[model samples]
Target: MYESFFGLAREPFSVAPDPRFLYLSKQHRDALGYLNYGLRRAGGFVLLTGEIGAGKTTVWRAFLEQLPPRLDVAYVVNPKMSVQALLKRLCESLQVELPADADRPGAEADLIDALHGHLLLAHAQGRRTLVVVDEAQALALPVLEQLRLLTNLVTNEDKLVQVLLIGQPELRQLLEHPEMAPVAQRIVARFHLQTLSRDETEAYLVHRLTVAGLTGPLPFEDEAIRRIHRLCRGTPRRINVLCDRAMTLAAERGQLRVDRALVDQAASQVFDLPGLRRVGPGQAARWVAGGAAAVLAVFALTRLLPPWQTAGATVAAASTPSTASAPSSPSAPVSAVPASALAATAVPPSPSAGKHVASAASPASPPPVTASAAPLPHGLQPYDSQAEAGDTLASQVFGQHLPESEAWTRLARRWNPAFTPTADPCAELPRQGLRCHSSQGGLGPVRLLDRPGWLLLTGPDGRSTRVLLEGLQGDQARLSLANGRTLTVPLLKIAPWWQGEFHTLWRSPPAYAGDGVLAADGASGTWLAQQLARLDGGPAQDGAEGLALRIRAFQMAQGLRPDGLPGPLTLMRLNHATGVSEPTLAGSAAAR
Candidate 1:
């Protein structure tokens, strides 16, 4: 349904095991290598294992597509079968003639002799034979031993038959059983496939999109992709289900792009996230964000505290009346009472989570994190060179130190060089059909948004400095000063000074009139009805109650609060998702 709308030749995230859309991540590539090695080595048993929905079958199919010449193959998928049935199936797969009474009892000798005769003939012709068992973990002991016996159908120099066993992780553990010692001795090659990493997950998504005829920019926003990883945990099948649902929902809402809120909404509906799906989308986003921030703050603060400080603070706080109250002693540890923790109980701090984490993790005597004073000599480690290089690149290239405000000017020019800013850049930009968005998060949020923004840095002495973030390359960031000097610094190097604030520009939808609640009246209401029709597939609903219900449904699916009145965040997401021609870090509009 969404293929034409999203400009996709076909659905990109189908869960089917199609080798055509196979993405070879590092571990997946390694898994295929092991399979090929086993084929060449002609081992008695080759083992491949991974979690369910880990794309094992895809890799297996990809490997099976290319087989060497003179190789006869028999494949079995269903594992729940008797040893006699399995043997008969194998003979049938190999095209060996079976007796009319092959199904009769006590015909085991006939089946084995027939298989051996065929194998001997194939071996005489310098051919090899392979038996592949899918879901081999369920194979009974006798059935497994029989396969081992088949491997015994051998010549002096070469084994005539090879068996490959593929299943979930249990198959690997099954081989370690004391009872399966003979089978263990014959495993010449083995590999366990693992889930993709965050980087690999991004690559996997893009690769699949590119293969699905997506030549435009990615349909998934960076944050949406990040959320997909968190929800799916790198499982290929889970990613497929989540992405497909999100796109369909976006398409129905006339959205061309998928964002974090859309992903959360899709996950709430499709996946089994308790409490998330039952509530309004906005509340669920808050719930998830709240929980993550609380956990992150506690963990970050605990890491920054010394053991003695942590223990003292805990004891003192317990001795005090309430966690909300201040300590009696002036010398009490600052951590003795957590003011934010109590406030967070009533209101979640999801938007400011990065700020909280940065503050909590900051040391009391926050050390200076500025780069080296002078350039390092040659032959030092790469990090040292990079650290010193950032300063050098900043100094000699951009010799003048411009205040942070100048970063905004540099950022603005990137979108339009001839554009002149009014008194209030943020306010003025909106009038020009552009917008200024400020967010508090680590480099991750910036990278996800895929925009060049200015970051506010708090110096060791508690001074605020601003630097222009021009671009990012892998782990290195390209930061600029006032006069266009740019330096490449590892992202980690600058993490110490950055306080989670990022300022960037985005294009606004036509006649946006700024951020506010959009009601069920006037031009906004007419527009809302038009947009909702795509999803609701019904006549326009203009009455407050009727329109409110449709609006609420859209909000819930987008993971908004479902206030039944759309606002800036809600409308901006609609613009991005529905193809309003905004600039992105990914370059082009796959959504359009």
Candidate 2:
């Protein structure tokens, strides 16, 4: 209903894990890194653990996206089956057939043989096989042991079959049990996925909007984003739920934008805030106190006092009492006040004052004046959430400063002068390397990515650095450095950037204006110019430089070499970026 009012193509905030709406936060990156590490390691286990609704499944999907073609993957999403059933499922996922009506023992033997054969085949093909069990906590102890035994299928130098166990926090406890010691010890990488931060939450909202084809300011106010982060506590799933509800509410109310009020309303209805009742004891007390005060004031004015009085003397005291007054019959009407005046008096001051007093008098009281009623703990903003955690783990991973955007821009400029200022320059440094940006764009949408066990660090060059997958936490991930340091990344930053083959067709030369700018053709260029004109500052001296930057960004975004040159792939990206029709290029000529 409100789409037209909001100028939206679709609801910007939906809880569904639409791969199109995934936002990879820092925690997600770490989770992906863990998955990657587990898959790459030789014949060892990897564990990923996270809280409920932390986007473990989404992270798993993202990891699948980045899988090398040679790696054979078996994903087990359900873990409630018996050991034999679990084995059968795994085999089925791997396309290994079992004999019909095979008994449990027979099935196990056949499954093992098939697995062994597949592993050998994979080895011959220079590939590795990985078995990922999601919701591993649901697996029985015997089933877990059976899984461990599968790891026994190995070459003399390394185990051929890799296992990944992903589950909630209970899985961690399960692995630590005495009976599961062997399995726990076999884990080579582990990571725990965490929630997004406040800033990340904002980016997450915008990201969803952009992915949904929005090309303007997001529909949510900053305060609304903050409330969402607080209410969701950085959990991707919770954020999605709350945001979806908020959008629905906004649409229902025929509002064009989502604000703090809408988010608070949505969060209150969705997430069960145990101690956050809408009209709790504090509110009740205030209402009661105000009512009592009003009553007391009325009693003092109407019942006890005369219409006029001197300093300590009543009006009647100044005049002698007239015996003729017949003792001023007590039952007689003594005074008359206009009913309008009384009604006016009955209305109390705005509730705002009472709320302020309550908040100031008691620090524990929720601040009513806050943008939203949701409470966000420290260290939970989107950008800070991941970057801070990465920084914590950086010393252990790279032991140095990460590179900055300026460095990457300088490098791109030097490598390809045509890489004009318009290109979005990015660099992937070695282990502990950082990608620098001249001007960092605001946070994008929140989505999940498949990057396993990825960490962000600063290189010795004073830039950022990243440590990919060293630890696992259930099907989610926890970041860790080689030195045993651990950190959590948000889910938004870990989500994969949206791009495909057509991504390159949208590529355009850099335009020196602002981030996310693209110009594929005359129409797109006109649109870009129009959008630039609407900006507070006019377009840069060379809009081409900005276009170049976007192209660079497109290159990095598309997993290209980040050379800042507009090849066929670059052109495709430009087409995608500008939402223009892709132009056909002959053979490899356009690519060059």
Candidate 3:
């Protein structure tokens, strides 16, 4: 219905086992290789299995088109029958005529005799007989055992007939049974087809569209493709269903492009889910900013507690009754009074006590504590050298499959929003409930943070590279690149680019409560300017002029208006820029 409306010659998404429409993805190619190997070997069974609608039959049909002339083929589409009925179906597939008047026992014996004779005759004629059973998972144990016994017609060199079993994943389970050991042992080649990757899914759609006679650009947008891949899990059958419905919906609406909304509407109808809509960029920023604020508030509260407590204590002491005001010593601890008596006797300090309060109170003496000097999270080991830290960090991201080794994979899995490989790692960091703090301080400051991070390195050729700083040993630093390369460099041997610009990924707190005061005069402004300086990978500046210049530079870099005033969005970006981990949207979580 959508073909003509979309200016196509044919329907691109017909859910049939059409060999011409087969998209040979990596898994499909591998499966075809396995099937070809079985045919060449010709002495044993070849097993092919996949999830339902994963294109097992389509792959087999593609295989059938390339069959050699020397191979005599018999295709069985249905295998859900008793042994006698199965044998009859097999005979019928081979075009062998059965005896109409024969008894049940006689007919069974005759069928086997004829099949064995027919295979031997084909072998004598320099041809191979191959039987392909579709949905073999439905075949009973007795029927399967009988098929296994048929392989006994083998000659001294090779079997006269080969068998190929194709079914859903259940076929693997059936073959794993102890009773099916003989059948399993004879299988020379096996492959389980998997769904396509996102890239492959996109290509598959285009290929189908081209085959259906589209000469123009693809109708689906990139975001639409992404959503389709996510909702369909890269299953071609489901993708076909969704795309077909989406195309029809688009046609009805007179829309030329198959946009994200129509794709979502089609998916909702097909999958029986609610309609999905893209979150506005502003809304997403708010969520990320909210999370970041929570993180800052947590650390800020911890940092400011001493000052707040000291001030509170000073006020409390000033209000305490003097030795002359009551029959109790002013130095007595509050705990000295019985709980019941204290609760009943507690009263507000009188205005007269205010006269002596200032002279007697000195509780607000301790200095404020900053979180910058706080220790790293537990279990995060610090390195003495930048190179050592980078190597250890690299091993975690690009290393082999080791426990607690695949750092990126672990973070990606834990992140609220599902991340695709194509996503910008830096841009998605905030949505992951984490932030990336970039600093231009030397290895001393980076190491002082005592957290794993990605360090920006500039080569002698002026090419920028990123290395993971995992840990350190003595004076040597462990650094690793995305390509699985590692280096152990002494602190003194660090590169010029190692001028200390690095980004760290870390967790956010459970909640955030704050005044959101980022750009203020005095100390807070200085702190904010320092953070912006670090995020800019530039020298720390002093006074308002330097702060404004740095803020404008950062705004320009982030593609924001260079107003020099840090607004909510600017503050959000600043927080993310100084955050410990990459942030990604919780779109997947919201969808759920």
Candidate 4:
């Protein structure tokens, strides 16, 4: 309903786990890495455990996206089946033929044979095979044991199949059972998926919105984002639900932006807080009567006390002088108090004596004691000012230079966890204190002095170089080079003051300078050329001998045969040292 008003192409906050809408946070990336490692390292089981709606399936989809075409993949979405049935399902997924009357053992054998054949075929074609089982926690022990046994199928060099098991945290506990230890021991890689951080939640929202065709700033306010973070605790599924409800509420009310009130309302409705429900007039009267009785009882008790004690009661009552007046008669109108006022006055203050009341009423007296600071909700750590400063520095760097590259944006995402970018990187990296100058020099070394502080240099050739320096001002800084060109540095690239762990780290080699040192003798003599290339400047002689020396050194460092014949590895290493990728050789049998 609100889509047209906001100019959105579609609802941006659906709870469904659409693969197209998958956003890989840091935790998601780590989980995917574990999955990839497990499958690539054959002869073992890889386990991925996470809480429900933690995006395990999304990571699985991402894994499938990056899989090479040559590899055959079998995915088991449902794992609640008998051993025989499970084997049959695997066969069906792999498209293997089975006999019409095949029983348990028969089906198992046929499936194994088909898998073996496929593995051999894939190997011959320079490929691999992987089997992914989702919700493996539901698999019975017997079925899990069978999975362990399947890892036995292997050649002398490598395993014929790789297995990935993905499920909830219960899966991990299940694997700890004595009966499942054998299977657990076979796991080569494992990662537990976790919820996103507060900043990550914000980024996730913008990413989804942008993907859904949102063109403006995020509809949610900062407080709304924080509220969603608190409510969902960074779980992608919960965040989606909350955001969806908030958007719906905003649209219904004809609001362009979803504010904190809308978010709180949605949360209260969805979570069903009893206190938030409104009471009718009859209920309200009863509540007010009960409150009045309690107050009168306290007042009667105070009246019976000595004058000195009663003075405290009187003072307390005076401190909270009510603007409400008593009804003149039984037929007089009853004043209706606002809910906000009632909420504010629901709790009574402790009684104090007349002396305290006089002090409070004095013109120069201080205000009543109030809470100095609100405690952060559970599970939240206090914000680190240093980290925030560092992020500010890094944001400035990218804001000024390399604004168009996705890699740069990813860097910014890492540096400032709070920034959420849609499709356009332009709006994300604000241009503050950003200045750029073109230089004639090649890419210069990037140094991080402090977070949000950076100095980037680009050579006369227009190739850029990045360095992050600590203690920079604003989100951008400018440096003038010798050739009358200026370089722009974004603050996001700035390194934190404490990140300098290695003051003596080796410098990156100068480009193309290592190309001229090679020796002619071959594998036995390449090491000498490497040492010569490491020397300060170019060799005294710029002849064929000098070039041969550099080549020998490059070949030796790269572990090549080093015949000094300029082989692929030798040229490749030399190119890498010079910051270039060697082109593939054409018409060469070895290259082919």
Clashes in predicted model 2:
125
Candidate 1 error regions (>4 Å): 280-592
Each model's lDDT? 0.69, 0.54, 0.64, 0.55
Model 4 lDDT tens row, 1-592: 5667677787677766676677755466456545644554556898888888889887788667656466777788889988778777777777767556557454776666766776677677777667889999999998898888777777778777778899999999999999998888898888998888876787788678877877555688766888789878888888888888888888888888888778878877776666446557876676567557546755784668774455445445423433342222222111232112222332322222222333344353333332111222222221221124445432332334433334334334333445455565433344321111111211111211112222343433444534332222222333322222333343222222122221101111222222333233343234334433443133434445555544443333343334545532343344334433211111001100
- Judging by lDDT against the true structure, name the best candidate: 1
Q: lDDT: which is higher, 1 or 4?
A: 1
Which runs of model 2 end up more than 4 angstroms from their true locations? 1-5, 104-106, 274-592
**Going through the candidates in order, what is the number of backbone clashes in each?**
8, 125, 33, 52
Candidate 3, after superposition: displacement of residue 439 in Å? 50
Candidate 1 local lDDT, residue 330: 29
TM-score between candidate 2 and the true structure: 0.52
Alpha carbon deviation, residue 127, candidate 1 (Å): 1.7
> Model 3 reaches what TM-score against the true structure?
0.48
Model 4 vs. true fold: TM: 0.55
User: Which whole-number lDDT from 0 to 100 does residue 60 have in model 4?
Assistant: 81
Name the candidate that leads on TM-score: 4
Rank order (by TM-score, best first): 4, 1, 2, 3
lDDT tens digits, residue span 188-268, model 2 = 888887767676777666667777667555677655776778778888778878877887898798776889888878878
